[model samples]
Target: MQILIVDDNNPVLEHIQSLLIERGFESVTASNGLDGLEKAQQSHYQLIIIDHLMPIMNGFQLAKNLRQNPNTAQTPILFMSTQDIGVIKNTAEAALVNALITKPIDENEFISHVYRLLDQNTQHQSL
Candidate 1:
């Protein structure tokens, strides 16, 4: 599966890429929201990990646009944020997001969340 990891932090992007690679997913990394969005349009992804606060474009806005596009409407989006979960939910409907991961990352939680979304995406494609 092709997965895209978008984060302004190089360390965070690399860490996520390592985890996805271990899980047998071919991944791409983007430094910011604009680059990530462009890449998303260029190729379909099984999953996308988007960072909440970023320069040029923020995670919520990026995700909102992705969902609006026909090509990416069903693509699962996982938003990573250091801010409170309530705040992120307030910015966008909680149910609209596939999942949310809080920062100071936990490896297991990240894998579990990503796996669940991937499974869901696969099932939907089969239908």
Candidate 2:
């Protein structure tokens, strides 16, 4: 499955991409939210992984825009942040995000969330 990963941190982006590759999933990366938005619009991704704090646009704004587009309205969005889970949860819900992961990422948890979201997306598409 194809995934779109949006983050300003190069190492983080590379790490996530590597993990996904190890799992046999293909991914596209964007350095910031605006770039991410453009890329997201130009193609279809089974899942979108976004960083909460970014230049040009933030994850919440990106998610909002994505939700307004019919092409991406139902796409699952996974947000990554270093902020408090309670705060992020409130904003994530408002933005229609499917899940949130705290930074200093736990590889196991990250992959688990990825798998669960992808599986749910697959089932949703089938339905």
Candidate 3:
């Protein structure tokens, strides 16, 4: 599966990409929200892991834009941010983003969530 990791920090992007790659996922990355949006428009991906605070667009804006795009409305988005839960909830509600992950991520938990999501999606598609 293809996964996109969008974050302003180079380290964060590299870490996530490497982890996903090791899991056999084809990874794509963008340093800013605008780049992420452009990449998203350019191709289809199975999942998107986006950081909340970014230059130009920000994760909330990116999520809202992606949801508005007819081609990506059904795509799964996982928000990774340091934003407070209340803010996360408000932004998520506006963007229809169902998943929110806090920052300083735990490696094992991140992988577990990613696998769980894909497994669930597969099960849902089968039925």
Candidate 4:
């Protein structure tokens, strides 16, 4: 499966990419939200992992844009943030985010969410 990971932090991007690789999943990375939006529009990804706070565009805006495009309207998104969970959840619901992961992320938890979302996506596609 292919995943798109968008974050401004180099280390976070690398870490997530490596973790996905370890799980035998391929991924593409973008440094910011605008770059991510361009990449996402240009190709197909089974899942998109986005950081909440980013330059040019933010994750919420990215999600809103992606939802408006028919090509990506149904794609599952995993939203990551360093903000309060309650606040993020409220905003995420509007964006139709499938899952949430808080930053200072726990590796195991992150991978678990990734697997669950990917599995759900696969099942959905089959249907």
Best by TM-score: 2
lDDT of 2 by residue, 23-93 (tens): 99999999999999999999999999999899999989899999999999999998999888787676535
Worst lDDT run of 10 residues, candidate 1, spans 88-97
lDDT of 2: 0.93
TM-score, per-candidate, Cα-based? 0.95, 0.96, 0.89, 0.95
Model 4, residue 83: what's the lDDT? 91
Q: Locate the minimum summed-lDDT window of 10 residues in model 3.
A: 90-99
Looking at candidate 2, what is the lDDT of residue 125?
A: 96
Q: Cα lDDT of model 1 overall?
A: 0.90
Error of 3 at 57 (Å): 0.3
- Give the poorly placed runs of model 3, Cα more than 4 Å off: 90-95, 123-127
- Could you give candidate 1's per-residue lDDT for residues 2-72 as a string of tens digits? 99999999999998999888878899999999999999999999999999899999887788888889999
lDDT comparison, 3 vs 4, better candidate: 4
Error of 3 at 10 (Å): 0.4
Report backbone clashes per prediction.
0, 0, 0, 0
Q: What TM-score would you give candidate 1 relative to the actual structure?
A: 0.95
| Candidate 4 residue runs with Cα over 4 Å from true position | 92-95
* Root-mean-square deviation of every model: 1.2, 1.1, 1.9, 1.2
Encode model 4's per-residue lDDT on 1-127: one tens digit a residue: 8999999999999999999999899999999989999999999999999998999999888988898899998899998999987877775354478888899788999999998988898999999
Expressed as tens digits, the lDDT of each residue in 29-100 for candidate 3 is 999999999999999887888898999999989988889998777777888888675676764363566477
Q: What local lDDT score does residue 8 receive in model 1, on the 0 to 100 scale?
A: 97
Model 2, residue 123: C-alpha shift (Å): 0.6
Candidate ranking under TM-score, highest first, comes to: 2, 4, 1, 3
